[model samples]
Target: MSAPALERAQVQHRTVRVLALGQVLGGVAFGATVSLGALLAADISGEESLSGFATASVTLGAALCAIPLARLAAARGRRVALTLGNLFALVGIAIVITAAAMRVFPLLLVGVVLIGAGNAGNLQSRFAATDLAESAHRGRDLGVVVWATTVGGVLGPLLLTPGEALGRVVGMPPLTGAYLFSIVAQTAALALYLIALRPDPLLLAQRLARDDARVALPGADVDRPVAARYAMLAVAASHVVMASVMAMTPVHLQHLAHAGHAGHGGATEAVTLLVGITIALHVLGMYGLSPVFGWLADRWGRVRVVLLGQAVLATSLLIASTWPGERMAVVAALFLLGLGWSASTVSGAALLTESTPLAPRPRRQGMSDTLMTASAAVGAVLAGLVLGQWGYGVLALTGLALVALTTLLSPLGRR
Candidate 1:
């Protein structure tokens, strides 16, 4: 490559790194909220069922706001839309804090909803990273952002320990302190984004597109339909399956213990620990090795990687269904679930980023994320119903069916 070409490549690499760091912080905030939200809700409401509602509310809110916020980003710019998301998160944290102090369930729900909206913004950060990258590195850059998320995600749960202690000192419930910490994390995330994400990747991509136009190759000017939309659907399906299966695991475990399967102990505490570990491992699977998946997508093909991920997820669900009463079996299943999510998410995001021009990047990103979160919400709701009425077996089979559907659609993915 020529000197100018090399320099451009270097700039793109640097831009991707910066965006990845920002994504890490954002992921930390998000991970903290997800890890602690259920416990916090249960503590606040004094009802286990309310935890389901709280989780659903957050996912539902994100789903509802995703496309709209994307449109806002498209019309205005990412900086404004992202800043707005941070502000919403700030408000949501306040509501949760107030709800804790007042012991109001409804108010807490509102807070979760706002936090979900904030998540919609966080999810778009990958698209921003991709906008600044060359096609060859697009998946890799997106994966780097996903990998960055692991740092915050791992630390978020650890914060729970300190947060719980702080809650005691402040005369608030321990779970309330988790939300407070989330506020601090989110505030820092906002600052990082504001300071580092200036100029906006979408705008940069637009400029690149214009530059490419001046030195256009054959077929370069023709608008290629973005493969990201289809990839987004696959990503959403994986998330929904993961959330649905993971959500009901604790309940299923308790039933097993009741039937004299797990072992001797207070089933509740064991179940709680199991749930926490499962979530942490699940998160690990989702973020860890994401870069590898992204690289594979760019190298081998996005659709093939996505199809492989779906197959992995289907296998995990099948395992979970076959041995519902075994703790060890369940843990292994969840681990696979996490891994499948990581692969699909990383690859799917990269596909989305490559599929669109800068002008529509943010809006498309937001739309994809919204669909992703919405599917998870639907899965959560359905999981609750299936687990309550039909049994874990039925849910697993249904998840398998979805995976098959995703596989069938895999051929539609971008090269």
Candidate 2:
């Protein structure tokens, strides 16, 4: 490789390392919310029905923050933007702790939203990985950052018992313990972003892309805005499909297990264990093997990988729809669903970064993240309703339709 090329590759390597560590820290917060956000809301609100709002608030927070964060990155550089995101998370988790003490519902909502803002940062970090990536390895590097989340995501909930014990000893509110651990984790993430992200990847990449102005690839003359938008849609649609399907899996598993174990002893525990394990496996599918897909995307091409993702999703949903009541079938389908989402999202993001030039990237990328979180927020609400009314089988079919639509859109992203 040329000297300049080697330098860029080295910087990209460091950037990915810092991003991966930050994600592990951020993922702790991400996983913590899944286990407690709703419960805390329900406890503080004194309304079980309103528990869902806790999760919603986080989603809304991420959606609301995406555009602003992107704009900030565009203006100030990624280090500044990412630091702000981590700061929001730190403050947000602190508020959650305070809200628990004060028994205030609204405060808790606000806090979770801020935590969601941090998650929005985590989501953006994937794109940040590509900011300096050579086109050939962009997918692999992005996949590494994406995979790092699996660690904190898994470890966060397991900390609940120990976190709660530590909280109880310190005289914290019942569920506030997790938030306490979250505060430490998020604080570390903030510090990591503030310290390690070095020299700002986005700004550096912009300069480099400007420096190497002569390099051109397939379809370089395509309208920048059109290509960018298509890439955004590909990323956003793939995300919503994953979010919508995964959101309802627990409820589906619960109902199926309940029916199957109506007369069984310890049925509640059995059902919980089943749902937990299945979801964990699904999470594994989403992130564990991402590097493999990333390599495939780099070798096989982006749009083709996107199409492959859709096929995986189609097969997953078909399995789900055909055998919704079967325990093993559902578990397998959920895992495949996660795998498909990983493939689509990873490749779609790579496409997005390359399709839009550096100058316009932050704006388009911001819009992409916003659309992802916003659509996911809406899709989750709708998925719950769909599951309640028509059942898991039909919900799977609906997700299938979404995958098919994304499949059709994938061709547009082709060079």
Candidate 3:
């Protein structure tokens, strides 16, 4: 290989390493907050109905912040954008801790939104992995960074007991313990990005573009808006389908238990255990084998993998809707759902990175994420309504319809 190529490869390797580490640490905070946010919201509000808003705020925050963060990255660098995001989260966690002590529900909501802003940064890091990557390996690099989140995602909740103990030692409320942990984690991520993410990947890529004008880099000269538009649609649609179904799954299981279905004779503890196991398996599916999917995306092509993902999602919805009362079926459905989400997300992300030009890519990426998060937020809200009014089966059916529509309208099908 030429010297420039070798140098670029080394830089790419170093950049991905730092980004992956950040994902792991950031994932911890996100996992803890997601697991506890709804329960805490319900407790604070003294109203079960308000519990959904906690998660909704996070989603909305991500959508709201995506544009500004992308613009910042566009103007300055990924390091600045990412660090600011983590800082926002750190401050948000501090507020949450304070609100918990004060028993202030609205204040908690404010903090959670900022935490979501941090999530937007975390999401953008995956794209950063691709900025300096070779086209042939883009999927693999993106997948590796995404898979790193699995570590913290799985381990965060397990630390809840210790976190709570730490909270008590510091004279904070027990429930606020997780947020305290989040503060430390967010701070570490912020510092790492600020210090280690030097010679920012995006900026470096821009330089490479200028130095090697004759050399073709992925999406560096693409001027086709229609192609990028299609890619964005695929990303957003898949996210909406995944978020909607996932949001209401636990509630659906609980309703089945109460209705005396397969779990009719089960105790509260038994039901809770079942629900926990199912969710765990689902998360495992989401993160596990992501590298494998990335490989497939490279080998089989991104569009093909995205189509396969749509099929998997459709099958999962079918099984879930048809056998809502069956415990094993529900578990299988959720696992498949996670796998489908991974496939679509990785493939769509790579496709988007490859379809847009470098100059406009940052803002375009931000717009894609904004649309994705916003669509998911809408889907999640509608999911609750669907589950409450009709039933879990109908909700699954609705998701299936969405998948079908999205797939048909996708460039994959049109081409």
Candidate 2's residue-wise lDDT over 138-220, tens digit each? Answer: 89999999898778776775666566778889999886676677878878887898888887888777666667754332232
lDDT (CA) for every model shown? 0.72, 0.78, 0.79
Per-residue lDDT tens digits for candidate 3, residues 1-415, read 6776677788899999999999889877786676566556766887645556677767778899999999999889899899989987887788777777788999998988888888888889989999998888999999999888877766665555566668778887745665676777888888899999988999888888889864446558766676577778888888888777776666566555656645356343343445556666676667776778888989988878888889989999999999988889998998898888888888888888888889999999999999998877677767766776777788888887768876786664223
lDDT: worst 10-residue window of model 1: 214-223
Task: Compare the candidates by lDDT and give the number of the best one.
Answer: 3
Clashing pairs in 2: none
Better of 2 and 3 by TM-score: 3
Give each prediction's root-mean-square deviation over alpha carbons: 3.4, 3.4, 3.2
After superposing candidate 3 on the true structure, give the runs of residues whose Cα lies further than 4 Å from its correct spot: 160-176, 214-219, 250-277, 325-328, 412-415
Estimate the TM-score of every prediction.
0.87, 0.86, 0.89
Model 3 residue 402 lDDT?
68
Give candidate 3's TM-score.
0.89
Model 1 regions lying over 4 Å from their true place? 1-11, 42-50, 211-229, 250-272, 391-393
